[model samples]
Target: MKFDQKSSDKLFSKAKELIPGGIFGHYKYAVRNEGPKFFSKAKDAYFWDVDGNKFIDLICGWGPMILGYNNPVIDKAAQEQYSLGNTVSVASPVMIELAETLVDTVEIAEWALFGKNGGDSTQLAVMISRQETGKDKVLKIDGGYHGANGWMQREGSPGTIDSDSSEVISIPWNNIEEFDSAISTFENEIACFISSPFHHPTSEDNVLPKKGYWEHIQKVCNEKNIIIIVDDVRTGFRIDLAGSNKAFNFSPDLVCLGKAIANGYPISALVGKNYLKEAANKVYFSGTQFFNSAPMAAAIATINELKNIDATSLMNHHGNDLKNKMISMAKSFDVDLRVTGVPSMPYFRIENDDKELHFKWVDNCLAKGIYMTSYHNHFLSAVHRESEIDLIVSLASKAFEEIIEV
Candidate 1:
């Protein structure tokens, strides 16, 4: 049966009249022409659209719902904090507790700072980098998404002056020679080198670092006295409890974490070495909601649960199972399918001469009560059990069959 989205369509019409572009940024409803625009509610591993069409969510709210939507433990923690008072004139003790938890949990994190979103942490990291090193240039990987802030935004766009990114340098990922050249070109002026642990560029097949790639980068950054910043906003706890830097076996000077940190709560953290504390104090990083204790309480609960349950390992196992099944099913149908990136965050690339084949396959999956996206990596939640994985594989087999029949 086809999924109904009549209510979603009506909402979209109203939204387009009221809000510019009908929705904001990455979650834009227009990205998938066949996807629903409004969801009535979401629970563990699933959500219902406005028309009451149920779907097994593979996107995981774009990477924040690591444990699952409306997780009871996390919500209860947040609710308890809310009852105590979410905001106060002075920062709550939960902030200190969460910081302490991160320092103890994340490798190389001796200090932590809170923010409301990924962009907040990233932008603050940039400021801290410059202030601490007294340098003007910052290096980044080409096509890497740090955030939507001025300096971190794409090189050229409206509303951002040339000076905003004038000191930033970009080089291709996984190429040590190019990285060396960029560093040499910028020399002593460079302050920090920031990048995601893996190459998960939008709409492209995700790329893993080659053997020794991260170790080499770390060596060079250390030799050059450049601070290394790992933007683990999308891959933090999902990769490992200690952060993706630990998963990749590389140490970073600073790490930006968000999304899954609080299990869908609006919170982010910039964890760094102790040396940067002075610079962090000098930088003006403040938000009214940044001190809200609810998300901090949720983060504490999430981190405790993650440690007890080994959630990362479970997610990776399930994700790998799904990847293997999808690949086998595609082979059975004689279709070319490639799965890339870490198991926890897998991107499926369809090799076909037909340009629309990917979209058609995703539409087929959506019709079959599965919510998958063609343009981004799929996330696996801890709640996706073996049975759900089996069901997803079966649905994917049908999606592959539909693609072949077309």
Candidate 2:
């Protein structure tokens, strides 16, 4: 299943001349030394590259395409909006409907604010939290990727604020003790504790909140009058229509969402209660592109489709089958590979390998037909049928045997 490499090599050489990393987004050269394979077209749960090689899509543009690639319903909605003049002079009527849908669907979302990307909504949520709480610092989960923007990247990127800065404190996830200590240490300065519902990039397993973790944190934050911001950029909509909070039995004061919204369209939402939303009015929260109607309409249509088809169940079924089969096959090979996280989404990594070693295994999988942007994370969408999951598990089994036997 090795794909033809000539066209992708040429494309990468040309792209490298224009772009510093020969790519435009995250995990560009991190997984593959040459760069990820370039796609020519995608339909349903599969994608074809410039070399005309087809493969099952496990990434789905980093989990945004939950309804699969080029879904007709969402595509038709976007096309109709374009026909009626995309981005109108006056406010789009669709925005009102989208807000209503969000308020009605999500558990704690009373008011919705729109943004173009995940980073925008996260920063906006942080701003609103700060404004409402009048605090300078925010407590963040270590290794949880919200987005590549100010409030997120500033803590760990090449040149930005230090991790222990006065404005933000990055603590490890699943460590309630550390979370409590950080809050006690920076109580007055801390505006909120913003975290991804599922711990990503650092830990392998989802390890969801350790039973009443959120409840305890909620109690502490409420007692201290601190806001809790759930960064649901990756987990929202896909985990549930209301996001992972629905499963966890916890509600945050504010939530930032993207990726799964609009079924891959460029839209992010900052949802909060009316009381907290009023703080947004006091601040200068504004974006020209945020009010675009196409993405908002697409989001409404996307949610409607998700509700109609029970997408969460479909996704979870596919992901769980893939995980179970892959792990079972890996065990047959006498390898210690483990799969972790929610059934709808899972992360994979070799137990006894360093970053480079694990990436080599992943690169091997890529050469065989699999595509995962990160070393550990792979997203499953509703488009991935049972056959595709079986195929992936079979390939992964062989790949694991080859990697571990050596």
Candidate 3:
């Protein structure tokens, strides 16, 4: 069942001379010597490697391929806008269209701003919070990732200095006591409390907030005037299209979105209430590509298409089916497979405290064409069919069998 990775390995070898680490950032870390390194083509819920090995993409381009790869609707939107001219001297009217669409769709969105990546949205959210509150410190959850912003990154990560995260206070997820402790200690110094709607750290079981957790935090932050910022970059569309915060029944001042927003188009959005509109305009955050028309057009089309398909509910159904089937299959093999987070974005873990065995199982799955990761959570797209769920469970059972045999 192992797929050949010769073509991928050779291409990576050539890339190493021209590109640092053949790939850089988080992507370089996902490299498996025996796994496909580069893809030649991708379609609905699946992809083909350069060597022509096919796989059911559980990672879903790490989250952006929510509708699926090569979705004709999304592609046509981007292509048509490109044909009209992608980047021009002025901002495109499509930007307005995209903003209007987000405002209409997102529950708390009274205004929307564009960025090229999730990091951009997160950084912009932080900046806007700081600008409005005039507070310099940020409060965040431990192990919560909001992109490569130095303040948000783990302290002392290579080029980042100690001061980059000096004003940041990290708290445990779902721990109300510590959250209060932080608020008491920081007092008026904290500008915003930014975190994903749920706790989804790498290499660990995902944790949801305890009951009344958001309600308590919301009340406290309101009293203290600390802006509530939901870094929904990773869990945006998959959880609830109105915004992840809505699912938890808590309101946030600002919501950061990306990954699945445009169905693989390069766009991220920062949506907020009208009260912050002035501060948002005051804080400057822009890039040359931020004004690109194609992504905006694609975003508009993607949002409309998601509504047309009820994509959130569809993905939830697909992910839940796959998770339940796999967990049941694992039990038959006497494996303790735990799936956490939301129904649409499931974080799978082998709960035996044996990391190597877990990795081996994931490697086995990868070799058998179920492209999943050992460390991070996997994304399920609306396009993942019922047949694919059965296939995934079957492949995962084989992986469990292999581990058992070993």
Candidate 4:
């Protein structure tokens, strides 16, 4: 059966009248004919659109639904906290509890700060680094995306001025020589180097850190007193409960975590070593909803569930299986496909740079009831079972057929 997006189309028309650019930001309708713009409901590993077209979700709510949509344990925790009260005139006990849990769990965390989004956490990390070092320059990965904020925006994004990135230095990922050269050029003026544990740049194939690459970077940072910030907003708990720093066996001065941390709740954390506590205290990072108890409760529950179930291992196993199946299927059809990044955060691409073919193949998959994006890495969740994996492979096989036919 084909997708019926009549209801979705009507909503989009109304949304265009009310909302700017029909839809704004990263989720804007880029593809000519994509899936529904609105979803009616979501359960474990699946969601239904307004027109009632069901899909086996592979995007996992853009990396926030690690435990899966409408997770009972996480929802119950949030609901219980909501019953008590979501926000108050002062901070809630759950906030302290969550902070303590984070410090205990994350390797480099001796103190924790809360925020409402990944952007907030990342911006705060930079602020703390600058404050601590009394420096102006901040280094970043060339193609990395920290957030939509001015300093983090790509070179050509609209409304971003030169001054926004004047002090921000961009370097290639997993390249020690380039990193060293940037450090030498900036010297003591550089305050911090911020990056994701792995390179998952938008619209490009993801990349893993080379052997000894992170070690060299960490060594330089330690020797030169440069603060290191790991922006694990998209790969935090999904990769390892403690943080990707622990999984990768390197330490960062500060870590920004969001997305999967609270299982789709609006929460982000800036965790750092005890040495930066004074600098963190000096920063003025605050939001009304940042102190909300519901998301903190959800995060606590999510972390506990992940630990109990060894969710990372499960997801990695399933993700590897999915990757293998896709590669094998693509070979059978003589379609060029390359899969990269970590197992839990697999990124695939059609070898040819034909944008139209990529879009058509992705659209075909959407039509076939599998939700995957061509522009970003696909996420896996603890709730994605073997049956779902099998279905994803079968759907991808069909999608490959469409690619070859095109």
TM of each candidate vs. truth: 0.97, 0.94, 0.98, 0.97
Q: Mind giving the per-residue lDDT tens digits that candidate 2 earns over 1-406?
A: 3556778788888988998878766646443544345889999888887877676777888878989899999999988887886777788889999999999988899999888898888888888988998888878887777777655774555756664344778888788899889988885888888988868764455556788788888899999988889988888876778767778888898888899889889999989978896898787767777778889889999999999989988888888888888777777866566677787778876676466656666766776677664455677887887888888877666666666664
Q: Model 4, stretches more than 4 Å misplaced?
A: 29-32, 353-355, 402-406
Which candidate number would show the highest TM-score if scored against the true structure? 3
Angstrom error of the Cα, residue 331, model 1: value is: 1.0
lDDT of 1 by residue, 1-406 (tens): 3667788888988998999888888888434656788889999999999999888988999998988889899999999999999888888988889999999999889999999899888888988998988997889998899888888888677789999899889889899999999988888999999999999998889998889999999999899889899999999898888989887789999999999999999899999999888999999989878888999999999999888888999999999998898888888888788899998889987888885987788788888888888888889999988888888888878876765763
- Model 1 lDDT on a 0 to 1 scale: 0.88
TM-score of 2: 0.94
TM-score-superior candidate, 1 or 4: 1
Worst 10 residues of 1 by lDDT: 28-37
lDDT of 3 by residue, 1-406 (tens): 5678889999999999999899999898789889999999989999999999999989999999988998999999999999999999988899898899999999999999999999999999999999999999999999999999788789989889999999999999999999999999989999999999999999888998899999999999999989999999999989889999988999999999999998888999999999999999999889979899999998898889989999998888888888889888888878888999888889998888677888899999999899889889989998888988888888888878877952
Checking candidate 4 for backbone clashes, the offending pairs are none
Candidate No. with top lDDT:
3
TM-score ranking from best candidate downward: 3, 1, 4, 2
Residue 109 accuracy (lDDT) in model 2: 93
lDDT ranking from best candidate downward: 3, 4, 1, 2
lDDT of 1 at 97: 94
**lDDT of each prediction vs. the true structure?**
0.88, 0.80, 0.92, 0.89
The alpha-carbon root-mean-square deviation between model 2 and the true structure, to one decimal in Å, is 2.2
